[model samples]
Target chain A: MAGTDTSKEFMFRPTPAIVLCEPQLGENIGTTARAMANFGLWDLRLVNPRDGWPNEKAVAAAAKALPVIERVRVFDTLAEAIDDLNLVYATTARNREMFKPVIGPDEAADRMSAHIGAGQKAGILFGREKWGLNNDEVALSDAIVTLPVEPAFASLNIAQAVLVLAYEWRRAALKDAPLPFAGDEGEPAPRGQIVGLTEQLGEALDRAGFFKTDAKRPTVMNNIRAMFARAGFNAQEVRTLRGVVAALDRRHERPNPARLRKNDDEQ
Target chain B: MAGTDTSKEFMFRPTPAIVLCEPQLGENIGTTARAMANFGLWDLRLVNPRDGWPNEKAVAAAAKALPVIERVRVFDTLAEAIDDLNLVYATTARNREMFKPVIGPDEAADRMSAHIGAGQKAGILFGREKWGLNNDEVALSDAIVTLPVEPAFASLNIAQAVLVLAYEWRRAALKDAPLPFAGDEGEPAPRGQIVGLTEQLGEALDRAGFFKTDAKRPTVMNNIRAMFARAGFNAQEVRTLRGVVAALDRRHERPNPARLRKNDDEQ
Candidate 1:
């Protein structure tokens, strides 16, 4: 309402719709609502709450997020809940083996931001507690949003999963164009330049006959490259390395003590 | 006494002394204990709890972390609580502009790890619920740890503060050494090599006319160095970069471009 052309600007896009498919616990719902409030998400659609609506536990859990719970919309089915939204993302832990792009929370947030920028209403569907969304429910969404988790411990609490995704989405939406560094105001060194620096250092090492064994060559080179890459060596760093390499080469090229002594004695 | 030496090796050595200075609420204490357990902090020192020792609420709130609460040692004064510890860090929300090194939870954790590695006991001091650690109590710490939050809304619950610090300490202590690049033989890159690489990369960029402008030079160069440092480029990456720089230089140095073009046209 603040921005008349809400659909045009990325930030002013319609708030994402959150659909809970038969959420069992009121506390979980309340926490989920609180998590949503943390990131400015308001729209909440409930499809068949187990203990009925307007639960006291949920109200208590909502704490400062009471406004979010007050505006909840109830639906009889998952399809009905997502009918108004143009795009829906299903939150799940399973792989599903679906061809639809399955992305982690960060990537999903990026895609969501792009869609929201286009002025389309998007929704994220969360499953019930005890058991998550069934195959039929998952099939309704455009994409699957999975939290990057260890394979052995994939299951995440309903509210926690929602919280993580919501946080990521808000971050992606609110962030300005990323600068080269965390706090600096400059473009990153061109990718080509960085690649070139890495190559030069490698050649210098090779010229110095550092890679004595063929088997150990790749490993040694990779370690060196990783070290430099991690350091974010700019153009200046490359020059410094060349100097060191040159110094080493010059030292190696100098006549040995035995050869010098033998020549001096002959003279 | 279960495997004293073995447990000692895996035992938590808290650098930030959790000082419950005149805490009134038993439930808060329990919650704080639970939070500490969540982050692998067991050393808790109470400075005059109001509702008597061994409160049921404290135990109930501690839940699975009752062991941490049980092990909490009570003292009459804050100084006595941290006297045995080698270094002490205090957690406070209020800005105390004292010249003493103030750090965030992450840095505090790093420092704690170093102290613990050197076999020195470390502790963090936390204040009461109603009014946190007083000026005098805070001054007793070797360093102050502050959580970066909005100035207008800076307060954090006692348990939450403990949780954050605990999380950072555990992360620093438990972080696994990164796998060695192909030829590194699982050994960490020596500090000297890393420093050399950093210097070399800086020099190379300067030679390639990368940092021509002085105004934005420091920012650009520092950022580039940081990026490479974070990437941890290995030997192979360094070589790759060198080749790229060589090619660029060759292209730039090619003389008689017009003559070459004429020859091409004749051909």
Candidate 2:
């Protein structure tokens, strides 16, 4: 009852079933269930698991994935397992001479999402842990989904493979999921604050005889104002920068009175 | 030298370093290594692994990830671990009260790719297995990367988290990886073949008295031709369809000469 909220959220949203074909290890099955649970995928179908159904080893491995394990449907054959699904993507590690469209995990997720959105049943087929999906199993699928792993070490553990697809599927389902939190930087400093800071800095620089000539004063002041405007500083940052300018101006007044007079003379 | 081709492919391409902070389990580190290797990532840094470095358990778990494990760098602290990296992303499962830009794995991967492409170092900081990264550790990161897992079961294994990020990074790095194989459907049937099939079918339909009225015959024939054109039949399909028509026509001839005479009388 405690974790039923996420399950409720997944109720109406059409999700792709993860069908494992002839999976050998129960631990692999359990871990795959866990990975599926992590990303909100509940439907898990097994086609002739070697260790058989109701495996204690799988149950033990599936820590908090009881719901997924509880609903696991074991079938005698791959066709029977995916009989009701309208679309199936067979995942493979190797390239065989087949005339199907092979796609990466991201695009596969997107396609699955669109298919599911259109009220069509969709699922992805994963093969055995050791030998992988046979050519016959792949031929049964509508398309092939492959991860872009390094060619030398492309083999992924069964659970790891499920995790990547589940993650992608969840992301695609969410469409443009907003970031969890955008820090409290709220908004940039308003124009009034920026203008005030710019004018204050201008007066301080003028007092310090920073302008070499009267003719260039407006242009230099405009450039300084433009710099402040370009920084896109938040309120806190603007306050800190203004404080820094005031501190420097104070330091100039206290440390070099003769230098200021000389600069004024030149001006 | 046997598997050096993939490493050569990664020579100049910028990749993200995987930095695990105070990872407690050696097996997790090992699996992380395997996952990184699967995705063409080699740089691995550890901030004081609990069981110490050069862990036998880790080595045993990393099946074919010797390169990643052998090149593992251990740092005294998180700062030292990420000190050289120009961009760092801290991965978290929980939504903390921090004010950083929280991004999903895909966007994070793209940003890291761009950062690395600009000749700047980038790394992703994964937290401890049990507790995860502290606020201070997250603060050091330029942004936060969170996976869109089910809220009820948001906890992901350290290795699972690494796999998702590594998978995303590889996909983003490749920009647009061609699918492993596009089945050889060859080219669609040539227009000449289509025309031949259409003419054969049209002759068969005319012989069968499918068009009842003389005035509507042209419109019905045009519709039939348009239907064939819309089907986009390939060479094999066109041949099969033509054979089907010929079989039906042959059956019609054998069935009854009397029925043909009756149809002719109606026409």
Instruction: Give DockQ for candidates 1 onward, in order.
Output: 0.01, 0.26
Where does model 2 sit among the CAPRI classes?
acceptable
Question: How high is the lDDT of residue B111 in model 2?
Answer: 93
In candidate 2, clashing pairs total 5
Best by TM-score: 2
Tens-digit per-residue lDDT, B187-221, candidate 1: 33444555565566566666678777867777986
User: Cα deviation in Å at residue A134, candidate 2?
Assistant: 1.8
Candidate 2: interface RMSD equals 5.3
The weakest ten consecutive residues by lDDT in model 2 chain B span B1-10
> Could you give candidate 2's per-residue lDDT for residues B149-263 as a string of tens digits?
7766666888888899998998888886664345555467899998899889888888888888888988987888889888777788898899999988888658667788999
